[model samples]
Target: MKTVLKALVLLVVVVAVLAVLVFTWIGSRGISARDDPSGLETVVARTMRRLAIPRGDRNRQNPVPATEEVLAAGRAHYADHCAACHANDGSGETQIGLGLYPKPPDMRLSATQSLTDGELFYLIENGVRLTGMPGWSTGTPEGEEASWHLVHFIRHLPEITQAELELMQEMNPRPPAEIRQQIEAERFLQGGDPPPSAPHAH
Candidate 1:
């Protein structure tokens, strides 16, 4: 009986070690594949295609067309945080983005076809871990407030012409403050209070 128990314990230990090894290998395998762009793109495409982690969409609708002020704020965030990885024009960057095993999605080309405002909201808010996206805590604790504004900007992105995109970029857009960021807790606190755009004033 003792011999059987010992065998079982040994098997459990081996299985645990193998699990860790597999994840570590996945992490490293991606880095090495960067040398070959095609292979890297293939892998990245596969991973992002994985069912996005389920999250509640903020119902963050685009009520009013983004004003220059609002769009500017979004642009600033994109330039500071996202542009490095996703690129200013939404074409995506080379070394950091393209080099990744799963290449970033082409937001500019596919926004209309591939994603919805709800799916985009959920994905941005929760973010995919171990992936390039870091969930914006704007509406959540520990995230920047301008996250929604960033979302506003993202919604408008598909319509931008190549030249217009540049002009808007150069317009010195504002950045959403770290404090003004709305989170779920605050909304709960307000209870009956209406959201920023109420009754479709547009």
Candidate 2:
């Protein structure tokens, strides 16, 4: 009993020391979303994420079957909702994605593809803390089914075709400025006034 108590005390002391060191490092470097995480930080974050998932959830299988129709639905959903951050090719190269701290992963890569269907679904539903991802759960069976469909779509990302990418591009949401530009261009082509010039900064 005395030995167990000593071991527990030692563990607490070690953890406290590590915490202090980590905070000191952070204080010295300061926090910036622009900076990429270090190798150690990446490993720790991944480890924590893995540990946080319930075993049952990690082992659960995807209930939604991978069908052409299902895939098409997933593709459309991704293009409309996820493409802003994840990109049509799952490359995570969009301006918003690039600006995020730790940025989105390239979903076609092994780091993302290697995750089990359940893990992917859980992440989609629950989201990661302290990251750009948000929980998409709607607390409905339909919502869960959609998330399952997305898992299959994520699996298919590596094999996504160019035609499909073009389709998704058309479906991606355009910014208001881009929409205005398109409208102006269309008007000009119809012999209307040209687009207004940008105002100069004072």
Candidate 3:
């Protein structure tokens, strides 16, 4: 018991020193959204996040059953709220997703897919700190159920259908400029006058 405690304490100290050094290096260089995390950074962050979840929470089973109805609700919810950052297929390919510092993860990959359902649920309910992901839980029963539903949908990301993608594109939020461009394109297709050009900046 004494040796185990000593080893744990030594590990903590070593990790703290390494963390300080890494942060100092980052501070000197300045972090950019375009910069990918170093292998060391990735490993450390992944380890810390896994350790953040309580053992009990990690072991808890998902209450929601996998059903088409549940999956449909999850799909719609993900399209409406998550697609901007995570993308409809969980590929994290959208502009916002790319721009985030750490970038949203590709959920279709084993890195995400391998996580236990409870871990995923915990992450959805209580988001990781220092990342773009925000806790989605509303502390309500419906919110909890929705999160559980999303877990099932995440598992299905690898097999997402083209029809589902098309539906999600319609559901995705559109910037006003993009919407206007679409409107102009539609007008031109209908044989209306070409959209007016913007004045050139001096």
Q: Pick the candidate with the highest TM-score.
A: 2
Task: Give candidate 1's error at residue 113 in angstroms.
Answer: 5.2
Expressed as tens digits, the lDDT of each residue in 1-202 for candidate 1 is 9999999999999999999999897787655735544667555754564344344453445444568887877777676777656767676664677865445666777642356566665666666665677776556543534665666777766776677667645543345562345443465576645575655222
Candidate 3: tens digits of C-alpha lDDT, residues 87-146: 898999988999997889899999998899999999999998999999998999999999
Residue pairs with backbone overlap in model 3: none
Q: Which candidate would rank higher by lDDT, 1 or 2?
A: 2
Candidate 2 lDDT, 1-202, residue by residue in tens? 9999999999999999999999999998888776778889888999999999999999989998899999999999889989898899999989888888788899999999989888999999999999998899999999999999899999999999999999988889889999988878876776657437743222
Q: What lDDT does each candidate get? A: 0.63, 0.90, 0.90
- Give lDDT for model 1: 0.63
Cα-based lDDT at residue 165, candidate 2: 95
Q: TM-scores, in order shown?
A: 0.53, 0.78, 0.75
Count of clashes in candidate 2:
0
lDDT of 3 at 21: 100
